[model samples]
Target: MTDDQPEEWFRNSSSTAWGFLSAGAAIAIIVIDAATGWHPETTAGGVLFALVAYAAFFRTKVGVSEGDFVLHHLYSTVRFPMAALESVSVGRTLGAYAGGRTFVSGAVGRPLREAVKGAKREHKPLSNHADFVEDRLNGLAQDARDRRGIKRDSDEQFALAEDVRRSWDWPLIGATLVVAVVFAVLLVL
Candidate 1:
């Protein structure tokens, strides 16, 4: 773990177990589809989708920890010398369009606010993926702050960190979605 370089975090044993289970499910899907010998293309698409889901759930990197900080899905790793961290801010709306449908559309504001609304509508507890990632980042941020006993994240800094966490995740999610959509299209055709 060098100061500036983030050490990639691999999936743990539980993740490995889940990966195996998911692989089994994928195999089962293929077997059933082959036995039926109908809609092979669609079945193949399902298999590919399952494979992608498996990779995402089991293979995606969790966090990258460097000397200064650790970057989770949305958050950046800690501050290191020469690491020009511009700013961190929290965002409400993370807009995206795919298949002519919007996912996670929110009014302009805070992610927490949107999350709360979602929870209420869905009748479930708040599921803030960004906040979950932020918790991990906060751990690292607090550690760095403690080491120096100097407060770095002012209101602006905190917001910037929140924003970094929110914005950084879109590209990764978008890439995954693109891959999945392409695979689906190829299979359908």
Candidate 2:
């Protein structure tokens, strides 16, 4: 095993960019429809929901830390200890079964894959980014058994405010509340 461990995780830059752009586009469409004197209320509701969903998706990330694989979402984070890995699935997305659950990510970012603006995507090296990431992930998982002195993430660190009944997920919940208030005002107006 090498002395160096990965300190950062890979992410899909293109998809991240597109998600934000789509959110902006939704807002624009809503404004345009409102000016047209159409039923903007219904459209506002749908777009607002989409905005919240996109925010959650935007916050998703997968990565490997010393002695563990981390899958992080908007309000929850699960760490599957390397020692508990059952198998690694490689394809359009990467998945793993550990800690009694299956975790998968389709947006494993391949920076080189989207590097050139108009380059053909079939290039050998760029196409293997998935393989590269997969191999790195698996390699660490395999090496985890023999590794020591590696600090695992504390339970507090993983303590994401996920309770929907409470105000834990403030950003998403706040958006929903704001939208509801707007809907109420619109109905009264």
* Cα error, candidate 1, residue 13 (Å): 5.6
lDDT against true structure, model 1: 0.43
Q: Enumerate clash totals for all models, in the order shown.
A: 10, 2
Q: Residue 133 error for model 2, in Å? A: 2.3
lDDT of each: 0.43, 0.57
TM-scores of all candidate predictions against the true structure: 0.41, 0.58
Off by more than 4 A, model 1: 1-16, 35-38, 67-139, 147-149, 152-189
Per-residue accuracy of model 2 over 6-119 as CA lDDT, tens digit each: 555756566578777777777767777777777757676656756665755575666766545666655555665554554565455557665345677655644543444224
In candidate 2, how many Å is residue 137 off? 1.0
Q: Say which candidate scores most in lDDT.
A: 2
Which regions of candidate 2 deviate over 4 angstroms? 1-5, 30-43, 46-50, 65-67, 109-126, 149-170, 177-189
Q: Please report how far candidate 1 places residue 81 from its true position, in Å.
A: 11
